[model samples]
Target chain A: MKQLTELHAMVSKAVDELTFPAYPTDLYEPISYILSLGGKRLRPALLLMACDLFGGDVEKAIEPALAIEVFHNFTLMHDDIMDKAPLRRGKITVHEKWNANVAILSGDAMMVEANKFMMKVDDAILRRVMDVFNETATGVCEGQQIDMSFEQRNNVLIDEYLDMIRLKTAVLLGGTLKIGAIIGGATSTDAQLLYSFGVNLGIAFQLQDDILDVYGDPEKFGKQVGGDILSNKKTYLLIKALELANGDDANMLDHWLSVEQFNATEKVAAVTGVYDRLDIRNYAEDAMQTYADAAFNALDQIDLSEDRRQYLRQFADNLLVREY
Target chain B: MKQLTELHAMVSKAVDELTFPAYPTDLYEPISYILSLGGKRLRPALLLMACDLFGGDVEKAIEPALAIEVFHNFTLMHDDIMDKAPLRRGKITVHEKWNANVAILSGDAMMVEANKFMMKVDDAILRRVMDVFNETATGVCEGQQIDMSFEQRNNVLIDEYLDMIRLKTAVLLGGTLKIGAIIGGATSTDAQLLYSFGVNLGIAFQLQDDILDVYGDPEKFGKQVGGDILSNKKTYLLIKALELANGDDANMLDHWLSVEQFNATEKVAAVTGVYDRLDIRNYAEDAMQTYADAAFNALDQIDLSEDRRQYLRQFADNLLVREY
Candidate 1:
């Protein structure tokens, strides 16, 4: 089996080689631009890893792996527009660089391109792969809608937030693994087990992100600490704090959330103070570990050699143990 | 073969019966709302008609037909936002009613839904059908992008305009017919012929629309007479006029096009005058007839019985022979 780093490099090289039509510059250019502004390419690498783990032909998996990568970027392009994000991976976003209309149309084109790539699979499993893909894609949209709706309401429950993240972020990871496993010629049961492992790990990763947003080393986090708190974003930490805080702590949290203006450091310091007092970090960490453990348990059940299993475990460990 | 009316009714009924999940009302509601505000369902009806022409089971074609309808509306929803259009079919557009973000997201979900419906095809043909669907979809997006690009440029050629219309408007029609023919057990050669017929007919239909925009009876034409003139839209008549006019006619047409504000009726009349002087209407009619004849010639070459050929020819005639 290929090492994770080797698979990642392969995916990156394939992404670099991708080309789009040159005529409709407004439509195809943004697609090329967004794909060029590379992310970690983690999802596609995991897909290839899953395929290799199952003894499938990794070379044959490259195009479908690229499909997952393209699909991931497509979602990011659209989500950037919906989120009004100006930057992606430290570069200007497609919508900001072009316009919303261009982004929208180009993103639509990317979805078609993703599907075209997906059709490269052997014809026998085409239907099953597409069924999973469509469901995953649909869930992501629904999750985004729910997440947007949460912005207007103050009553978002923790479970609902978990469901939202699972839909928005986790399913794609799970679906990516499942597609790879299918391509790798794994049994349906084993494919679904890999999907479960990916999902739990995904949820844990997002919770890790929530924690890192508030507490990670400024140098390593690559974003402003407590930015979520400054925007009153309904992260798991904030939601849990909202549920558990009361009296003086509640009043302080309310003031911080409601205030129209404050010094950036002051706000972060103040909100982080509230979280510290309530030990919301511990609560978030506990939830993250629970999911992480669940992911390992699913991994344990999969029918791979211990060496390969340890390889996946180490990958998950490295993912969660980001420099902080 | 069932009558066109019967096929159309089947499509409408199928569309009406379509339902989406009720949660995330912001996302799903716009989808249902836009689908409910129906057009003629012409694309899907034609799909069903093509299927029946080849003696395919009409019932088996319903889901894919609905896929075409949903895909068409998905384009309209996004296009309305890009065009900043206020109304569609005399009702408020989805973007206008719900907001651009909602329209964008809902349109995205609808695209997924369209693919889901597309997957209902028989197993043996799913990949082939999807190839056509994705290619058709990608072309439509490219066409819209080119059409939008033209808004900022004055040098859009007649051939480029034709190409844009073909990509944006005609290919979906052609692709729809081809998909239907494939489902109806058509040989690849026959399917290509039907596709050619649809493409030529679609171009002719669009040209007829351009002519009607200037010259049709205001009462019979659903849209405001010469609305395209008020907007300085580069339709065939206007493009041809710009190419053909010189001296006084050139100055007048340029003055009207470049003017920021004017009485809508006067602009329409003056533009119509330019068209009359250039005999642009006849040019448009002759071009339309050339395509119409090409469509008939392709239809004649198809392997279908003469009776079935006449049925399709009659359908195309009625489509072109709208009230005005």
Candidate 2:
């Protein structure tokens, strides 16, 4: 199997060659813009890695890889509009750069473009890939809806939040792996096991994201530290803090949550203090490790030899260990 | 082939039986609500008609037929949001009833659901249908973008308007016929011919709608008469009037176009008078006939005999003849 760096380079090269028509500049420009603002290309790399690990032709897996990449970006574009996020990857988001209508329409075009990319594979595998895609795409939408509803809601349960992330984020990762496995000619049993691995890894990845938002080194995080706290986002840390605090601590947390105005640094410090007092950071780290271990266990069930699985394991470890 | 009425009934029944999951009520509820708001069901009817015309089993065509119907409504939902329209089919639009965020997210899900429905066919047919659908869906987006851009510009040429409508409205109708024909096992030649037929019919259908907006009886129109004129919509009649009028008449039409405020009735009446003076109604009628005739001529190129083709012709004629 190619090294993770090699697979990531392949993904970046593939994305560089993607094109859209020039007539409707409004619709296609944002597509080109968002895609150029690079992420880690982790999802597509996982897909390619999964295929290669299963002895599948990496060349044959590129289209589905691109499909997932484009689909992931499409979700981000729409989510930015819904979140009223002004910046993406340190650049102005499509909606902020254009307008909500342009973003909505361009995002719609991106979804179709992703599906068209999925259709590039041979007909033999197209249906299976599509089945995985349909379910995953719908789940992402449902997850977004649930996320939106959570803003207005005060009684969100931990389980509900987990399910939301699972549907919105994890399933697509799982689906990417499954699509790659199918293309790689893995047996259904092995593919299902890999899917479980992806889901666990994905959950761990998001939990780490929550942890990093508040705890990561500023130079490494690539975003404003405590931005979530400043926005009063009910992250795993905040939720846990709220659930566990009592008396004056509860009132302090409630004051932060209810206030419409506050100094950003002060609020961040106050929230972080509450989280530290409640041991929320440790609870989150433990949760992340739990999922990470579950992912490794699922990987162990696969029929591949330990040598064949080493690269995937190393990739997961690197992802989880990253300060950013 | 079933009678047009029977085919429309089939389309309606298929839509009735279409269901979405119960969770994420915000996402799925708007989808169900929009689908339940009945329109002409013309696109799906055209699809089934094309399939039946090619001797394909109508049952196999039902799924894709519903796909087109759902897609049509999805477009309407987003269009209403873009146009700031409050009503669709005498009921509040999804955006009005719920909210823009709900409308946008629900519309996104509707597009995915439409694709899922398209996937219900055999894999062999699925790829071909998807090719048509992906192109048509992207074109619809392009069309909407161009239409939006036109709202900001006064120099929208007649040819540009025609192209926009072709992409936004006519291509989808043409795609419906082509998808049905492909599924019905028609040769590429016959499928292309049916697509042309649908395109011509679609153009004529939209022109007829423009005419009816200004000229049809209010009792039968089910909408405010001359609504397009009141809104300064650059329809064929208005475009032609602006093009044909000279001297004082041209100045009057320009005045109406530039006005920031005016009595709705007075504006409508004045525009209708200009159209009457310029004989724009006849020009529109003649253009509609030109397309209708072209549609019939394209139908003539297909393999079907006169007996089999008569119903399609009658359907087109009836659609064109409607005053409302």
Candidate 3:
């Protein structure tokens, strides 16, 4: 745990060193602002962790790790615009703070900057890094598109929803691990195992997010409890609830889903009632555990000894247990 | 000229053959639609032309050429949203045809696709190509930022506007030629020269566009004769007019600029009158010629024979002589 915190601090310092010119401050300011409004630095830490686990020089991996984090934030910036999200991590989003056009252009600049960082590696591995990075980047865009499309849709299948989250969230995480593994000179087989570990862990992480949105303590969650319910976001819990409900419960869910206006508290309470009756929380937890177990299973494929793997297991457990 | 036409046809065919999945039609349909609504294909053609001119196989350069064009179109799609442009190449823009969110996401996808195509090059020169491409890409975004900033201000200088356009419009052209040169095994010095040629020619091309917006016959221009004037766009002619105009003429220009709404034709005619009195057209033409001459001089640095150089000269002349 201490080592993870140190790794995160290193990532933060590397990110801080990334400065842009003051002029065209509108374009670059948001980039600097968003990077400063730090997240958990999980992606970059995962990258370096994966590299170090594979016996690669952690120092050499810092820039690419930073690149992954920048790319993730770029996605967040643009997605917030598309989502019309006013806030991210409890701070006003770039689009809301400045404007959509600035957000769009700045996000575009960040993506380029991400590529620049990815390219800073030795030429021997640059192409490999880019291939993974590009694939992950495009998958993320596709995931967001599908996610948007699902919002306008009512009949989103559980499989389709799962696929969407996998693309939208999981692949990049997996790609981050895979990137680190490649840079670490891990064998292809070991890299694939780490990638699988990331994918499954990422899925579990997102499923946990779905659960937290509804059941989490408001103070700890850092967001409005049941915000997704208000927005009619067809998350896994809602999809499963819809699939399992019947008669009165089905009609109630439909009414809440279709209602254009309702008291926020009432809507949330009534929906929570339906979720409770359906025992969707238990179902969600089980699903999350299933994926987490699969993630652990992937770790079994790696050639690392029992002790080295314990850190990743502990990290995943910590991620799963986070309230926010 | 014939070779250029042939090169263009090849580019069009290459662009047409590019396909995407039918599902997520909202995301990809716009991509296919935009590529189908062909523009001049000038950038890609220049890429191939440079490759061939340097004794490289044009076939090997096609994907990178397409990548350049795709990146260019990606910028166009996003810029259209920012500019609130409803039409592109006489068709409804992606934003209008679908929606802004669709345009934004599809543009993002197109950028990723552009990189994917760029990565299809032989590994020998991938990093070299990516370095030039990334620098050009970031410059284009910065150029756009400055252009937007200018729109909100009244005192945009000609020098600043020139710099903005060079970043916004010229670097990609320069980068395309440079990428082709690198792929064709040209020396770094020679590649740099071709890049300079492309940059100067691009500036000249854009200046011609400004001139045509005010002075060229409407029939041949294929766009509104005074579109820039109507929109209060800060073009070279307008900036120079502001720089040179005195007393009543300056007041007239200011009045036209500040008016909330007016007869479009009257405003265009009034602005053109100011430009004509100040010899802004002549000034713009002279400026265009200076850049064109610089481009030609860049070509002189290359060791190509007179016959080979004449093709480039003729291509530039054809570009300059276009009425639209």
Candidate 4:
């Protein structure tokens, strides 16, 4: 099996080689700019890895893998505008770099481009690939819509939050892997098994992200320790804490959430204190473990060489146990 | 062939039957709302007509025709946001009725839905339909970008203006016809001819729209005459007049364009006077007729029964010589 790093390199090189027309500078430039802004290229790499797991031609999968990446960035470009985020991956966002209009139009174009790329497979599988891709794309939009709606809502449930992440974040992971597996000539059953593996792992990864946001070393995590708390971002921890906290802890959490302004450090500390008292960390970790275990179970059933299965398990393990 | 009214009814019924999921009320409702706020359903009807012209099943073409309509509205939803337009079709625009973020997200979803609808064609023709659809979709976005960019520049050439209108308005019409022809099992050559016919006709229609905005009776035109002049929109007339006008006429036009504050009626009257002095309407009409003739030339070359050919000719004639 190809190593994860090799697949990542292939995805990066392909992204770099991507070109757009020279006219309509505003529309095409933002697209090129966003794609050039470096990320882990994780989704495409995983897509290639999934393809490789089925002994598929990794080269043939590059464009489809790029499709996954482009779609992901398209989401980011639009999300940044909605979030009014000034920066992405530590650079000025497309909307901010140009304007929201440019970002919106470019994002729309990117989506069409993504679909065009996804259509690059053999005709036999084109329909299935598109079915999966469109469903995945639709889910991501729904998830974002749900995420936005959550901001005005104070009564979000744990299940709803989980479902939101599943749609917004996890499904793309699962969908990419499934597409790759299909391209690799895996049976429908095996492709579905791989999809389940990616999805559950994705959920676990997001759960871990919630945990690390408040608890991990800032240098290692590469973000503010309690940014979600500061923003009242309605993460799994915040939702669970709201559900579980009582009396003084509840009052304190409520105060923090409602206040128009406060000392950032103190709010973070107080919220973390509430979370600590409620043992929200353990609850979240348990939930994370459940999904991680589910991922491994799905992985165990997939038909592939033992070593290849182990390789995926290792990748999942590495993903979950990142520098936190 | 079905009557135009019959084809239009079929499109309207298909649109009304379109159902979106209920959970994400904000995301899906705007889509339904926009779709319900109907236009003439011209593009889709033309698609079905094209299909019928090639002896294709109109029933089979319905979903793809709806795709065209959905895509057209998707552009409108986002364009309304970009233009800060408060109304569409005498009703509140999606952005104005809901919000920009809602409009943006819903529009994105609508585009995906358009593709989903486009994918409903038979498998053999799916790739070809999608290629045309994607290229068409991308062209519309590019056209919008160019149109937006024109607002910031003074030297927009007549050719550039024509190109912008082609990409923004004409290509979809052309692409729709081509897709319809393909679904009807037309030969590649016949499909190309149909495409050219739609595109050239579309350009002619838009040119007529520009002229009518200046010269038509307000009662018959259904819009405030000279609206483009009042907004300083860079239409073919404006660009050509700027190129052809001399000395005092150029100075007067330049003054009106640069002024931030003016009486809307007086500005329209003054601009119409300049247009009259320069005979800009005739220039625009000449250009419009050139495209109309090109469209007829293409239609004449397509391998269709004489009756079907005459039906299209009548349609084009009726379209070009509207109430104005």
Candidate 5:
């Protein structure tokens, strides 16, 4: 547990130390600027934590962990530019802070640097790391693509959405933990179990995210509460509403989604009303719990000493039950 | 030689046939679109050539070759977005055809797919390939960042510019060839030498490109001749021009770069005038030859059969001497 805390500190320190060469000064400023806008170094931290749980040298893993973080942020920087996202972590995005072109170029460099840093890992684990990285990277892209494609689709089924999140969100969480486990010399089966645990927790986290978006305390929620509701984002609750809607319920849901402009509060209230009628919140919760239970089950299946397993399980439990 | 040609064909066919799963249908459309745009397929094809040159199965090498090609095109898509000069091979840039966001995401996916494809290689070769791939990927990014950094500077030296291009343009070419050689079962020393050959050739290729951008025949060049001239890009000629300019020459060069509204012909004529004053074009020609000679030297130094080396050298020679 103490090691996990120390590993977290190391990830933060590594993030602070990274700098892109400044010769063609314009190209790398965005790299610095984007990284400066902080998010939880969760993926890398998870990797470090997984390493520590198995008594691996945390120092040996930090560079690779940092590589994962840089790679993740690089995607976000470019993704923001692509999504025309105005803010990240409540700050103006890199593209917004700078411009789209700079963000795109710097982001490309960041990804390259990510691979460069991963090269620091020992050769013994290189292929295993790279192979998993390839799949994780591909999965993230697939998830994003699926997430975007939903915008045009009339029928984004619950299962399809689950798969999308699996690709986009869960796979990386799974992969990161699994990478850490593998690096720490976990058996392949143990790595699989760890990965499944992280991935299932990730889904629960996302589903909780959807719930909190509508029902959260605004101050605790950080950003605009009910943003997903207002934006008509195809979150689990909304998607389930679409699936469960009948008679007047269907009509109201369509009207709300189709409404080009409305008061934000009214939109939130209307959507919440529909959710209440169908108890979509419970549906989302049940679905979320199903995955969360799966994650715990996965953790239980791991062959680590029970104490190590419990620590990992406790973290997952905390992650699922968090308010923010 | 015939087998070499078959190797090239087989790698090309595999690259052409390689398809990534479309989880987010829109995410990778840009990749397919750009891959569809078609270039010489030189990088992957070179890998195959190197493989057979080393007496390795072209079949076993094909996926890794495709991986390299996929990587090459990913760089192009992202680079095109950064450079913002439309029309790669006379087609609209990915950002132009789709949005910047899609190009960025798809490009990321392409890079991931490249790694995924490489992971499928025999485990024996897979580790070394990933190491080379990591090195090349980082080198490419470093080169690009340096190139970008150079854009904002006034006193960039010729050697520094050469270094930048070596990172930006040459390393991947070297890397591509080395991967092929490695996969093809070339010895470590030979692979190292092959990498140098490819890198040196890449540097020469870029220098030739700079020359052709200003001087190539319009139709044969397949681009807007003098495009770099108009952009005030920091090419070898421009870097040399900055170093060599004196009296009125320096003033004229500065004025030309600062001018917002010069006719294309006027801009080209003025830039060419500066190039002539310092014999910058001749300096560039000499520099290009230096690199080309180095490439040939590397090729000659390899332990592989001279007859085998001859055809590849001949192909590269045609490139070095081409007017367009």
Candidate 6:
């Protein structure tokens, strides 16, 4: 709990320190605007905590910690432009606010800034850090590419979806955590363990998000509940429902899916019915907890002390067991 | 000439070595496709020559040398996507070939690969190389922003234009050469001198491109001539025309600028007359020479054998005086 406070305070400071230099006009102000319209600063905080837990100086880790977030935001800005998403975290996406051209250029500048920030990390760990960052960044792109490919396909298997999310979302956590542990003077083996832990946690976290997308209460979800069902987007429960639905329930699922126009409320009710008949909710829950358990196993394998590990585990558990 | 051969060979080898593991199918193939459609290996060759002139091992500097060109191409790829350009060097741009989504994602991967290649340099010089690279990359984005801003501005001075080109086009040349010299074991001061040399050469090179854009013979030019004039696209000549045209010529220029439709050839001819009356070509030539002189002056100040410096100077002269 105290370490979570430490994380909160450090993440706040890191976020606050990120401001754009005044340009001739408000040209680069979007860079600051997106970072200021904040989200959960979880990746960078995980990196900082991993560094501290591994006995590295947290101060030295802050720059790269910040680098990871800038890199993340840069990806978001560009991806939003490509996806034509209008909003992020209930705020205007960068492209929506300043047009796509500015969003693309500003996002490019932000990525460059992220690399510049990473270079500010001391040379002792710079090469290793760059290597890890490079792999993670590339993985993130690969993940995005895979996700886009899935849009054109109908029968995306559970394994394929898992791999896509791992690349798109999970490896960043592992990469950030490993960079911290490595910079903090962990041996190669310890760094690998930490990376695996973060990765498994990422997989579990994404599965949790998918479950919440359908089953969670609409008012408490803060965003759309069953939004994916309306869009006919492939998530775990839908793929499982397609796989497990028996005769007439399958026919009912097909009827809704085959429609030309979407009705969100009706779709949500129908899909929840299919999920209940097949007990797909429990299947998804069991699957998510398996990964969460695997993540804990990976964490336990690391050489970190119980106190340090306990805080991380508790934080992760709190994230997993949330109602909405 | 022998140095050019060595560089040409190295570039050929470097291009061949670009391989990303192909499992994810969508994520990395775009990068390989983009890099494989090669153009003139000008930037990397210049880097190798700069190193060889300063007596650095060409083998050791090859990856980092190639990094400059790779980084350059990465910019071209992303910029083309943003510009909605149809082709690059007569090849379909990555975005055009495989959609904007693939282009955007692959471009991100290429930028990371560029950093990975640079970090492969010796540990002692990695810090400085990254510092220069990070700075140059950010400068490039800033220059691009300014260039886009110019499209909306009615009055951009020649000095401001030069500065824009400095950030947009020249700093990376300086960065490439500086990294080459440092890897070759040039003293810090010698590296700075090499950067100056590259900067001056780059300015001249760009002015020459502007010159060729306006006046080169059609067959030898390899593209449309006076295209800048036809579009009323601001170039050095057009800016000078705005500053220097008198009476009837001024009115004609303004009319052409306002006219949305005209014969492209007639527009070219009309602008050519304005350029002749204003003697804009000669003024631009003198300006080009001034910067070329500055580059040579910096080369003269470098502490190297006169014979060795001759090759580097000649290499630059070859570029400055290109026909096609």
Q: What does each candidate score in C-alpha RMSD?
A: 1.1, 1.8, 1.9, 0.9, 2.9, 1.9
Model 6 chain B weakest lDDT span, ten residues long: B1-10
TM-score of chain A of 2: 0.96
Across residues A1-324, which tens digit of lDDT does each residue of candidate 5 receive? 445667788898889888777655656777787778778887898898887777777778888898888888887887787678998988888888777767877777777778777767777887777777777888888888788878888698999999988888999899898888878878889888989998999999999999999877778777688899888899999999999999898999999999998999998898899999999989999999999999999888888788888788778777877675
TM-score of each: 0.98, 0.96, 0.96, 0.99, 0.91, 0.96
lDDT of 2 by residue, B1-324 (tens): 677679889888999888899999999999989988888888898788888888898889999999999899999998899888989998999988999999999999999999988998887778888999999999899999998998887777778887888889999999999999998999889999999998888888888889999998888878889888878888888877877899888988989989998988888888888889889999999988988899999998988878888877887777788675
Q: On a 0 to 100 scale, what is the lDDT of residue A96 in model 3?
A: 99
lDDT of 6 by residue, B201-267 (tens): 8888888888899888778878789877876778888888888988999998888989998999898
Choose 1 or 3, whichever is better by DockQ. Answer: 1
Task: Give the clashing pairs for model 1.
Answer: none
Per-prediction DockQ comes to 0.89, 0.85, 0.78, 0.89, 0.60, 0.68
Candidate 5 lDDT, B24-86, residue by residue in tens? 667767778888887888778888888878888777877888888888899898888888858
Off by over 4 Å in 5: A1-3, A17-29, A54-59, A219-224, B1-5, B149-156, B217-227, B230-233, B246-274
**Candidate 2 chain A, which ten residues in sequence have the lowest lDDT sum?**
A231-240
> Candidate 2 falls in which docking quality class?
high
Q: Could you tell me the TM-score of candidate 1? A: 0.98
For candidate 5, the docking band is medium
For all candidates, the clash counts are 0, 0, 0, 0, 7, 0
Tell me the TM-score of chain B in each candidate.
Answer: 0.98, 0.95, 0.96, 0.98, 0.94, 0.96
Candidate 6's C-alpha runs over 4 A off are: A24-27
Docking category of candidate 6: medium
Displacement of residue B235 (Cα, Å) in model 5 is 3.2
Tens-digit per-residue lDDT, B1-324, candidate 4: 889899999988999999999979999999999999988898999889888888899999999998999999999999999999998998999998889999999999999999999999999999999999999999999999999999999899999999999999999999999999999889999999999999999999999999989888889889888889989999999999999889999999999999999999999989888988999999999999999999999999998889999999999999999768
The C-alpha stretches of model 2 lying farther than 4 A from their native spots are none
Query: Judged by lDDT, which candidate is best?
Result: 4
Cα displacement (angstroms), candidate 2, residue A264, comes to: 2.7
What C-alpha lDDT do the candidate models reach, one value each?
Answer: 0.92, 0.89, 0.91, 0.94, 0.84, 0.84
